[model samples]
Target: MEARVMICAQTFFHRFFMINNIAQQPSSVPAGPKRAGEPEHTPHHMMVAVACLFLAAKVEEYPKFLDDVVRFTYHFRHGKEATEALMADKEGALKVEKDRVLTCERLVVSNMGFDLHVTSPHCKLGPVVDAVLEVAAAEGRTDLVREHKSLLSLATNFLNDSMHHLICLQHRPTRMAAIALAMAEKFMVGKEKIKPFPRVKVDGEMVPWWCSMRIVDDDEAISSDMMRRYMKDFHSQVYRQDDDEAIS
Candidate 1:
């Protein structure tokens, strides 16, 4: 359930960033002098993130209360004592925080042009995984079928991890889904295991199984080198924090 909500929230943030032309901005941009009537301060990233989650909950039909969203976000950021104080409305801080979130929500809505629909890669993951497994099984890769649960779980984890990065924004939903499944297969059964799945001839060249599945258009077709690069970045970037947490 949380995963579903986060996926929606991530998509919302992606769209929000794009709409505001902030997606490609460098990490730190120098602020220009303020103009008359311009806001004294912009919304903090934390505030925007919380607001995105709050709005995404509604868009996804999960519908968490605003108070709960504010409270949990506060708790996650500031720890138990601060959350308790905020909940108790100490010095009217709770009201102030909620107001900030509301303001950010309005900003997000306005910038997004009120378009709330988000197509998540999770929607495409299931069918692609099933198709791949079916093809593998037909080719006598029975182990993949036997380990279906693990494969699916790992693939789903990849999809979830993708939310933390710009990967979803960089690739189409179907391509992301197919790459996630392929990554899962490589991790579970080794690279050689994937070679048995039949490829399709596209314009005198053989393409991977996913390309034939129409997971990506002919022009957007993924190459083996590209897959390797994605996998390399996924390992180096996405799972870096997980590795650190495990180490500590």
Candidate 2:
């Protein structure tokens, strides 16, 4: 259920690849003291947001129709009150949006040095969740195995929400997947009174950079607690955007 909600919402912005941190991109760029004259076009927030949605429908395997994506995104951006004019004049709206999408897509593709392949954490979900469960079982914690299905749901939601942050790109899909599971475990322990086990660490990989970005004390694979902190920090960024949007 959570997965479906996220996948549907994500249909708009398939890959919002922003190199700049959310802290750098404010809702409104304030005028500063004049520097050497320059205003070269870079992909801004709205452009990247819409383009990701437009492109995702085409690129993702299940293939939502272009019309569905357009309408879905429109409602997502502007609540769910669509009138006849909005629905009837789809072509006109889409033509304008497509132009914006094209410009942003080109800039993003080029800006990232043409690394068009944007990896999503969805694929690595199974192995990551299994690792969590396996760790639990090894620790003689059958309670986690008993609630595996719910934890899987929680993990899916966490990964989906995590995608809202540009920091996701700094980590590999596998690392993102593992982080999602760790986050799920944290929620599971706190919400359901599940016995908190010792933090399970992934043996091989170094810690993801985002985890080290003041979220963790040292460079290490994020444990359950570190991931919870990371997500708390991450969601605050999303909330900031939401607040700005509401005001604007």
Candidate 3:
């Protein structure tokens, strides 16, 4: 169910910009957060995810009725609710959740400092990929770069999927793009790329991604090992069984 909500959240982000001119949507003015008690009936994570959908609707201006969003979310989350009508008279719980959604929306909008414009993975990651390629070339890995002609595109694809997870909100777009690109490069070149990088205490006996990727960008502040750790944590996140259903 979280997967479905996450997909919807990503959809809301994309759909908003798609409906509006790609660059025209203004950053949401800081409207300030609402002070409401955490919803007791539904999981806090569920409310937060739903709130993202509701907030996206308003910011993008293709407002989805709160009722529709509620029913849409509950329907997939609960198999029994799958056939339920959107009508308000059927059950008052939908209305309650609607209020929760609105409240949470306010909290999210305020927390985000009202920024609404979403960055494309390409735009966000292009520089990172270019920098990595430049580093590879300088390190005499141009042979590998030339062999992987579609490397950047492949990395972008991985970023597209990574955006489905909540990490986008947690980390900088460029950082995620870099990690995705590193992973792509790793896929193309086996462990042969691993170099002896500065070890981070725990991996003293093990070869970390930083050692493997030869990524030594000080500005990025994340070692390949840390990036690999993030990747491990990210992939370990709970995946929703109903993800494809939501996207479809």
lDDT of each: 0.71, 0.55, 0.54
Candidate number with greatest TM-score: 1
lDDT of 2 by residue, 160-231 (tens): 766665546556676667666665666677676466544433345444322332322223545546655555
- Those runs of model 3 whose alpha carbons end farther than 4 Å from true positions after fitting are 1-43, 60-63, 80-91, 112-122, 126-154, 160-171, 191-248
Clashes of 2: 4
Q: Cα lDDT for residue 89, model 3? A: 45
Residue 204 accuracy (lDDT) in model 1: 79
Per residue, candidate 3 scores C-alpha lDDT tens digits across 1-248 of 33334444674543333333433322331122334783222225555667777766565456777777777777766655442643444445555556667876765555555665664444656665555566556667655566545667666676667666555555555566666666666655554443322232334554443333333332435655587666665555423432222211
With candidate 1 superimposed using the best TM-score fit, by how many Å does residue 203's alpha carbon deviate from the native?
A: 8.4
Candidate 1 segments whose C-alpha is farther than 4 A from its true place: 18-40, 191-207, 214-220, 223-248
Prediction 3 global C-alpha lDDT: 0.54
User: Which candidate order results from sorting by lDDT in descending order?
Assistant: 1, 2, 3
User: Model 1: which residue pairs collide?
Assistant: none
The candidate, 1 or 2, that scores higher on lDDT is 1
Query: Alpha carbon lDDT of residue 68, candidate 1?
Result: 89
lDDT of 1 by residue, 19-60 (tens): 555444434311222358964444556667898999988888
Residue pairs clashing in model 3 are: 28-114, 194-212, 195-211
Error of 2 at 120 (Å): 2.2
Candidate 2, lDDT over the whole model: 0.55
Q: Alpha-carbon error at 209 in model 3, in Å? A: 16
Give the range of the ten consecutive residues with the poorest summed lDDT in model 3.
239-248
